[model samples]
Target: MTSVTARTEREVTRGRTRRSLVRRETWISAVVLLLPAVVLLLLLRIIPTVTAMAEAVPLGGERSPWSNFAYIFSDPSFLNSVWVTLLFSVIVNPIQIALALALAVLLTKHIPAVGLWRTFILLPIAVPQAVSAIIWLVMLRPDGPLNGLASAIGLPTVPWLTEPGWALISIVIVCSWVGVGYWMTFLVTGIKEIPSSLYEASALDGANGWRQFWSITLPGLRRPLLFVLVADTVSNFLVFAPVRILTQGGPQGGTDLLMHNISERAYTLGDTQAASAATLVLVAIVIVVVTIQFRMLPGKED
Candidate 1:
């Protein structure tokens, strides 16, 4: 009996030793696989952010270390850019999300050639934003195809990229055209993940389409919707290519978003310090907005 007990103990010891070696090997493999991505993120994102923050600080000779920030706040152009960016965010985010959600629902239904339709919608995403902006630039010209079509339809000509108000609206249109399809793809994935059994069960209980959407679809989509909202808000806030290529901050700074404003200050006016300060402000705004979104749309604990 004693010999049997010793044999059992030895077997247990061997099992644990083998398990420990396997666990160590797994960790080493994980680190090796992740190392390249970690290095790239540090080089691309962290280093640039640190450099921007360092550049934003005023030199020792200044009356205050926050001179750059003060200057930016005092500037009317910067203030206008902030207001414009806020307005753009408010308008563009909802439009993109709503359209994307609608398309996701429609495309996910039992429709013919759904994959082809999805590809057509997502084709814009394959095109670079700068190129898309340039294409829209021509399309929005006073004598361009859009206005020509308007004339043919007996409608008045619209100053798409020429006027301040219309320029902002034109930017919104261009952005939405590209963003809606991209966002829809994510929502489609989210919708697909929801179990079909829920729909079937709800149908048996006589729950209609709208009821099922309200009860199951929305609840199932909570996490993906939250992600889409946060990501869309951030991307809209960082909008520059469309504004730069189409309007160049526009006829009277009407479409001068914060990113374009920063570029103008840094590249056009040679104010790197102010640009860096504005970059920090933009980062702060994104952080605050994302925090609020997380609080408002808290994900369910698993």
Candidate 2:
């Protein structure tokens, strides 16, 4: 019996050893396959970032390293652009996330023509942003269909794109129209991943729809919500085409966002160094805000 037990132990040890060797070889093969792509990613991302940072620093005898940054801060138009970008981000991020969440929840319900409605909701995402901006520009013009309808209804004929304040609001509407559907897809996917059994059990416990949503859906969507917030904030910060095509950062520079300002600096004024500095500022803002979000968002520690 002792000899039989010893033989069994020897076989088990040999099996573990073989499995370890196979796992090691598989890991090595995977790394070997992935190394090229990893190197390319670093070359594309890190090298450009380092180069841009170096360009931003004015390396001369008289100029300070932060001279570009100083010039940007001193420029009134640039300051206004920063403020517009921040205000736009603050307003649009919540609206988009909330609207997307609401739509995602509604779609998950058994409404009539549900699939068709979802298709209609997502159709805006398929339209290119530039095309959408042009369409919106036509509609929001002073003599456009929207104003015509307002005139018929005796509502005031308001300026949409011509004015500074209205242009920013119009831009927000356009962004929400284009972005909510895309964000909704992520939320719907997240909601679907949650087990239905939880809802069923909650219903049995006399929990209503709102209660279930608060207790289950909201908690289930922490990661997805975080992703949407960060991504949407970044996208909104970098919005360029609509402002360029519609407002051109006009009406006293009201809609002059960060990206538009950066482009104007880089392309129009031939100030690549200033643009690089502005890019760094934008990158820093994104990093700090995203880091704060990461810390504040719910997790296992919380």
Candidate 3:
């Protein structure tokens, strides 16, 4: 009896050892599979960012980093560019999110030709941003179709791209039009992920559509909404192409964004150090905004 018991104990110990070995092998395999992505991120993103930060620290030669940063701060125009970027991010991000949410809610319902509507909405995203900006620029021209329609209705032609006040507004309108559909896609996906049973329960409780959305849909969508908020803020802050192709930060620098200013300084003025410094400042602003967003997000304990 004692000998039999000893043999059974040995077998159980061996099985445990095998299970341990299998777990280790699985963990190692996962790490190996993830290695390529980790390496790519380091090579493409981390290394370049570190290099940029290093380049931003001047070595006391021509265009010293300190002098470059000082120049940006000292110039009233550059300071205005910073303010413009902040204003754009603040205004565009929330408005885009709200509009996208509204559109997503509308399209996700039992509407007719839903697929066609979604396709049309998302078609703008398929077009290159630069191309879209150019198309809008043409449409907003003083003698373009929009103005022609306005004139036919006895309304004066508004200088969409030529006036300082209207220039920024025109850029914002184009940016929102191009971006809202893309953002709506994310919200639609988020909304669809919600369980149908929850909606049924809310209906049984005599809850209206808006109340159900506020309680059920919004809670389930918190994470995705947070993600969209951060991403939109980053994208808006780095806005450049529209300003570059549409207005060239013109109409007296009304549409001058930080990225446009940086590009002009780096490529046109040949001020690499200054551009690097400006880029660093942009990065810092993004970090701060993201941090604040994360901190303010609900479910912090979780």
Candidate 4:
């Protein structure tokens, strides 16, 4: 009986040892798998941000450690760029998300040739933004295809890229054209994941399309819509390609977004310090905006 008890104890010990070995191996494997991504994140994102902060610091002879910030804040062009970037964000983010949601809802129906239509919408995403801007540049010219079509339809040929108001609007249009489809793709996926029974049940209760959308679709799409909102906001704030290729900051400073202003400061004006400062400012603004979005959006915990 004592030998039997000892044998049982020995087997339990062996099992625990095996379990411990398996756990250790699992931990090591997880570390190995995660190392590459951690290294890349540190190298690509964290290091560059730290370098920008370092470069934004004042020189030895400066009045304060914030001289770069002071310099940019005092400049009217920089102030204008800040305002313009904010305005652009305000205009573009909502328009993109709204149109994206609209298209997502429309396309999720049992419409014929839905795949072909989706391809046409998402085609712009496959094209590079700079290339897309160039295409828009030609089309937006005074006597280009857009204007010719307007004339053929007996509408006035609007100065798309020339006037200040229209130049900013043109930037918004170009950005929306690229962004809406991309955002819609995510929304469509979220919509599809919603249980079909919920829609059917809602319909049986006499809910129409709009009512069903509000009760079923919108609630189901909360997470993806939040993601799209935050990402679209950040992308619009960083808009530079269209502004650069089409307007070059424009007839006035209408489309002079912060990124373009930072590039101009660093390269055109040879003020790397100011550009770095502006970059930090842009980062701070994005952080604040994203934080607000997180708080506002309902999450799983909510």
Candidate 5:
């Protein structure tokens, strides 16, 4: 009996040691897989951010960077970029979120040809952003197919990309076209994760479709909505490609986005310090905006 007890104890000890060895191996493999991504993020995001702040401070520079912020603020071109960026954000974020929500709801239904519809909606997202912008740029030109169709349909020819106001609006449209479908994917996933029982219970309570959406859908989607809002805002804030490729910030600087403004300051005019300062400012704006979004959204319990 004693020998049997000792044998049992030995088996238990061997099992625990084997399990510990396996767990250590798993953790080592995870770290090995993650090391490259961690290093890349540090190099690409963190290092650049810190370097930009440092460059903007002007510790050993000839001219005082004390005026760098003042320079960016006082400059008319920079101010216009700020205005353009804000306007774009205000218009595009809501449009994308609303359309994404609507599409997500529709896609969740048992409709005919639903798979095809989802595919078409998601086609834009599969295309690269720069490629999408170029495609839209071509479509919006005066001699483009869009105007041709407009003329053929007896509608008035619209200036999609030329005029100052229209150019900004065009940029918003282009960004929304690519962003809406991408955001819809998240909303749809969130909506589906909501248990079907909740909707059935609400239905049994005599709540209509609209009521269920308001009570069940909206409350359940709080987290995804917050994510989409903040992400869309950040993306639109950093909008550069449309302004660069299509309008070149033209029609009297109408589409001079903040990123373009920073690039011009740094590369075109050889003002790295000012550019760095503008970058820092842009980062600050993004941080504040995202923080506000988080605060405004309903918490998990709510």
Candidate 6:
């Protein structure tokens, strides 16, 4: 009896060793196959980032990257542009996220023509940002369709692009309209991944649609929500096209975003060092925002 027990233990141990060996072998093979992808990413992304960082830090008789950064703070216009970028992100991010969440919930219902509705919502993603900006620019012209409709209704044809105060709001409206659909798709996909069993159980417990969404759906969608928040924040901060096409960062640089300012400084003003420093600051700000977002998320502590 003792000998038989010892043999059984030995067999179990050997079987475990074989499984572990197989897993290691499989992992090694996978890594080997992934080597080319790793190399490509390093070359394309990592190398350029390092180069940019190096360019941002000027050394010796050359305009140091630090000086370039200082210049941004010293220039009142640049400081105003930074503030504008922040305000734009703060105003647009929550509104866009809320609209997207609401639309996701609406579309997930068994509404008529649901497929068509989804297709329409997703169509904007296929439209290029530049093209969308141009289309909005045309529509917001002084005598464009919007003004025509306003005139027909005996309402004022407000100066959307020409007025300084209204210009930023116009850009924001266009940005939100173009962006909401894309973010809504993410939320819709997240909601679809939730198990129907959870909803069925909630129904059995007398939970209504809103309750189920708040308790079950929202918790399950935490990761997707985090992803959207980070992405939308970064994208909105880097907004340039609508400003360029619609307002051109005017009538008094009200809509001049960091990217637009950086581009103008680099190309138009021939100050590559200053532009590189500004670009680095923008990158750093995005990283900090994303980090804070992730840290504040519920499960991030775990």
Instruction: Report the CA-based lDDT of candidate 2 relative to the real structure.
Output: 0.92
lDDT string for model 2 (1-302, tens) is: 99999999999999999999999999999999999999998899999999899989968748899999999999998899889989989989999999999999999988899888888989998998899999999999999988999999999998998888999999999999999989999999999999999999999999999999999999998889889988988888889889999899877898998999999999999999999999999999889988888888876545
What tens-digit string does per-residue lDDT give for candidate 1 at 1-302? 99999999999999999999999999999999999999999999999999898889856764688888989999999999999999999899999999999899899999999999999999998899999999999999998999999999999999998889899999999999999999999999999999999999999999998898899988898988998999999999999899989989988999999999999999999999899999999999999989999998866786
Better of 2 and 6 by lDDT: 2
lDDT of each: 0.93, 0.92, 0.88, 0.93, 0.89, 0.87
Clash count of each predicted structure: 0, 0, 0, 0, 0, 2
RMSD of each: 3.5, 4.6, 3.8, 2.7, 3.7, 5.4
Write the candidate numbers in order of decreasing TM-score: 4, 1, 5, 2, 3, 6
Model 4 gets an lDDT of 0.93
TM-score of 3: 0.84
Query: Between candidates 1 and 2, which one is better according to lDDT?
Result: 1
Taking the tens digit of each residue's C-alpha lDDT, what string does model 5 give over 1-302?
A: 99999999999999999999999999999999999999999999999988998888877768775778888889999888888888878888889899999999999998999878888998898898889889998999999998999999999888988899999889988888888988999999999999999999989999999999899998888889888888888988988887888888988998898899899999999999899999988889899989888888876674
* Candidate 6: segments with Cα more than 4 A from true spot: 1-40, 62-65, 300-302
Better of 1 and 3 by lDDT: 1
Question: Once superposed on the true structure, which residue ranges of model 3 sit more than 4 Å away at CA?
Answer: 1-43, 59-65, 300-302
| Residue pairs in collision within model 3 | none
Steric clash pairs (candidate 5): none
By summed lDDT, the worst window of 10 consecutive residues in model 5 runs over 58-67
Question: Alpha-carbon error at 169 in model 5, in Å?
Answer: 0.9
Q: Write candidate 3's Cα lDDT for 1-302 as tens digits.
A: 99999999999999999999999999999999999999999999999888777777867577655776787799887898888888777778888999999898899899999989998988888889999998998899989989999999999899999998788888888889888999999999999999999999989999999998899988888978988888988888888889999899988888899999999999999988778888999999999999999988885445
Q: Which window of ten consecutive residues has the lowest lDDT sum in model 3?
A: 58-67
Count of backbone collisions in candidate 4: 0
Report lDDT (Cα) of residue 94, candidate 1: 91
Error of 5 at 259 (Å): 1.2
**lDDT, candidate 4, at 70:** 85
Model 6 RMSD vs true structure: 5.4
